[model samples]
Target: MVRWWRRPWIVPFAAIVVIFLAFSIPPYLSFDPARSRVPQPPSLGVAHFWLLVPHVLFGSVALGTAVLQIWPRFRRRHPAAHRRIGRVYVFGGVLPAGLCALTIGAYTPYGPSTRASDVVLALLWLGVTAAGWRAARHCRFGEHRRWMIRSFALTASIITNRIWAAVFVIALSPQLDTTFHGDEGLLSWVASSAAAWLGWTLPLLAAQWWLERDHLRTRRVHSRPSASPTPEPALPHP
Candidate 1:
């Protein structure tokens, strides 16, 4: 039986979703008050708009390439391709996106909860990607894999955040009147803050747990003693 994780379609499906969102995000990329997700008060002017472009662009690059990097068969068959994509994910995606994120996070007009979450995710994403790159350079493939998993989990958060927001709205629709309206109410803010905090964190924790479990299973297999053939020497002596 094919293992669930080993299913050939899994990575493709995930990649499709990630890429679809990456392409779809541009329509909403405007800094105009009508399209912006966050309120753009007068204090946050053209500078905020400029920073957002790289943040979204490189962030999309990170999201789009991460699945290819993690696709097991693809990585095995095209190691050079995997390395190239990894470089794109780091240099082309995470570095510019993360730096932009730090600036945006500091100046976020949203509540403190969101600012904190954004800053934390930005720093973690950069640090984790850098660690993975260093591990690969040092030829520590196992450590590299683990760190990359964590970094990709953060990359995936961009999509997960939107998904959770939709879920929160759908679930709380009856209770929260402003869910459909343009105005942000107390409930909406609470849900947004909670999603911000949980979006990347839950995925990172799951990835870490999966990596740990796989490592333990590998150790068990390595430590297991192979059975040797029973002695047939008695007939030889005779």
Candidate 2:
């Protein structure tokens, strides 16, 4: 009965989410080879670009579905519609996106640090989503909600990933001459790698913290014993 979605920030939060997705998804929608974030050319070719495209597109599906899924009124009023959206989120979104991410992460042109972080993120995303789906399948609504919220946190971390990347690039770029021996490339790589780890990890940790505190508080309240009728004294004298 904990209604985490009934928050005062819902309107502003939705507005921010709309803007975030606008920034996140437009470049990839054109499908122009040049617009791809992954480097192209004789160096890497169009194959990785293709992979990046599907990953972004499918992830967009997941993100869109997550926005709908978290809408408490819609979910409460239309259970069937909510279930259908959840299905698309799992099948059309997470599965394809996660596979592409796993592939791209495995053979990224980036350094070991970025590769490791991305690979682990993909695996955890896939695993956590699957767990949520399983919980729903078993009709464990409470567990399902928690698991799905965790999944959404990971999905939405794509925004944080870009935000952190920009932050690191700005902060570290200035240090190129002093710390990186004027190596702009090294500074960029370091920034990217660090962002890859902190972006998802920090957000996911925050989500877990929020969920854990609620769960702990509820559990403690439930664990307290209820008052009972006084027991009849045994007829020891008889």
Candidate 3:
């Protein structure tokens, strides 16, 4: 059986889909403020609006660079490029976006659950990315890889949240549209809260699982007997 990673096309395909969604959605699709609730805080003031733009732009950059960074081939073939992009992912993308998340999440017009989730997500993203960088500095590549995977998982939350929202809307349209009306009611709050928490958390969990599996596979390979036992020299003498 072909290993999942050895499929050759899956990673690039997924990366393209992720990058496309991350880059394209914001520019092309217009979100209704009330329904989406993302623009509500920014709509209140110019400062908030400015904050929102950098948060989104840098977050997208982080997400894009992060997708590239995870490619083993890229990291192996272009180590310097990987480090440079990693820098951009952290400083340019993750840090600024995290700060933005903190600012907007606290003051969002959305309910308390969303605010709290946003804050948690932001802090985790920042912390994990920073941890990954520190690990790399210390030459702890394994630790760095794990933490970076975690950070990317959180970064991918921006994409996951949208996916969750789309799924919810499509799957539960009648109930969501009628009872909740998209963030205007209790059900809406519940849905938003669930999405907010699950988006990053689920991805993080999956990343950890993948990392652990990879680690175990590596250990198993290394631990395997490297050579066969030699045959007794002279059974004929016996």
Between prediction 2 and prediction 3, the one with superior lDDT is 2
lDDT, model 1: 0.81
Model 3 lDDT at residue 155: 85
Q: After superposition, how far is residue 200 of candidate 3 from its true place, in Å?
A: 1.0
Q: Give the TM-score of candidate 2.
A: 0.87
RMSD of each: 3.5, 3.5, 4.3
Number of the candidate with higher TM-score, 1 or 3 = 1
Q: Which consecutive 10 residues in model 1 have the weakest lDDT in total? A: 32-41
Q: Report the C-alpha lDDT of model 1 over 1-238, residue by residue, as the tens digit.
A: 3454778766666867666675656655654535655555357776776777678778888877887787787788899999989999999999999999998887776667878998999999999999999999999998999999899889888777877877886777676655545555666666777788888899999899998899999999999999988977656555
Task: Give the winner by lDDT: 1 or 3.
Answer: 1
| lDDT string, candidate 3, 15-100, tens digits | 67576655654742343233333555544554555556677777778877876787777778899999899999989989998998
What is the TM-score of candidate 3? 0.81
Model 3: lDDT of residue 115? 88
Reference-based lDDT, residue 207, model 2 = 90
Poorest lDDT segment (10 consecutive residues) of candidate 3? 28-37
Candidate models: Cα lDDT each = 0.81, 0.86, 0.77
How much is the lDDT of residue 144 in candidate 3?
Answer: 93
